[model samples]
Target: LSSSMYEQIFDRTVSVKQRDREVSSFQLTYWINWHRNRHAPVRVLIREF
Candidate 1:
């Protein structure tokens, strides 16, 4: 029973880390897209003028 409990705890910790990694990756992609979009309009306007 103690071993099983330990395993469960370990599994929960691993899942939490996995979730954190996924969230960070999602944030990174979002940041990159925002950065690109922020500059895209300026570039377009410069080209037009």
Candidate 2:
């Protein structure tokens, strides 16, 4: 019973780590896209004027 509990804990930790990695990567890409989009309009305006 103790061993099974330990296994469950380990599995939970691994899943949490995996979720964290996925969230970080998603946030990174989202930030990059936002930065690009935010700057693009300004760049175009500067070019136009």
Candidate 3:
């Protein structure tokens, strides 16, 4: 998928995850941690490429 598509999916998924956790105060932390973890699969895909 295109980068924008990836971003949309990521944003939606992150929002859902944050909602599930109900940690509005720690949103920045959750975003950072979730973002870090989310890149793992892309890294693997890059390596494969």
Reference-based TM-score of each model? 0.39, 0.39, 0.45
Tell how far residue 38 is off in model 3, in angstroms.
6.3
Query: For residues 5-26, what per-residue lDDT tens digits would candidate 3 score against the true structure?
Result: 7666766665676568565647
Of the candidates shown, which would achieve the greatest lDDT relative to the real structure? 3
Worst 10 residues of 2 by lDDT: 40-49
Candidate 1 per-residue lDDT over residues 1-29, each given as its tens digit: 36445445544643564567566756645
**What Cα-based lDDT does every candidate model obtain?**
0.48, 0.48, 0.57
lDDT per residue (tens digit) for residues 1-49 in model 2 = 3644544554464456456756675664564456446443334224322
User: What clash count goes with each model?
Assistant: 0, 0, 0
Model 2: residues with Cα > 4 Å off, grouped in runs? 22-49
State how far residue 18 of model 2 sits from its true place (Å).
Answer: 0.6
User: Regarding lDDT, does 2 or 3 come out ahead?
Assistant: 3
